[model samples]
Target: MRRRTLHLAAVAAAALLLAGCGTQRDGTASPAPPPSPRGCPAEVRLTAADDGRALCLTTGGRLRLTLHGSEDRPWTPVTATGGALRPVNAGVAVRKGDAVAAFEAVAPGTARLTSTRPLCARRPGQNSCPGVQRWTVTVRVTAR
Candidate 1:
């Protein structure tokens, strides 16, 4: 009788563990997908122009991104995912103006571009820069 009780308890514990494995903290079965960009289609496709707006891209296409900011609040591209995109040129400025940062879509895959800028005052010789603002955009590349 003791052995039977122990075996039943072990089976119950295993069942409970398996049931909890696929649940999220909110008790949902699966995580939600990322939100689609506003005014964009639900399906992935290239936009008509590369006007720095977030949109999907066709494989082997080109995208032109322009980052603008003042000298004290300069923005810069931090990273890009996948090998489908390559930067053409990038720059920094002290005054508000357009800085062309172009990229090319090399292959069919999803990619992300991230840029950031300082939003708070910085002291001399300080290692850490606080109040950093980040901008991230997702791009889907589809084969033609």
Candidate 2:
């Protein structure tokens, strides 16, 4: 009687283990499918032309900014206002005198991304430039 009970217990345990293995009717195990991507526009690319323009984005997406500048009057790094967007830590490689920065959508809200450079280059030890140049854009983020 004890031997029969042990045999039944072993069979039950084996069945439970195989139940979640996702076997097909033909007795072949099927691989689990990959998770589907969620959200809209996985990445948003921006340029100087986007300045002052309103943009939309989905959560968990990236924002890439590329602005033009010269060596003497290069743009400062991009900055985002409010809490909707956060700067990406990985540095973007600059190409052809373009100033680049990357950010990630963190929450559902509005944010202003801005970058600025000097209108004219100043000499070394100069405290201030003659004028300031600016670039900015508004972004609206939502969960999709």
Model 2 poorest ten-residue lDDT run: 27-36
Give me candidate 1's TM-score against the actual structure: 0.51
lDDT per residue for candidate 1 within 36-82, as digits (tens), equals: 45422323322213223345666666665556655666676446888
The number of clashing residue pairs in model 1 is 1
| TM-score, one value per model | 0.51, 0.62
Whole-model lDDT per candidate: 0.56, 0.75
lDDT of 2 by residue, 7-124 (tens): 9999999999875453356643243323246534667898887665566778898998889887778888788899999888647567544578888999988888888888877557
Clashing pairs in 1: 71-94
True lDDT of residue 112, candidate 2: 82
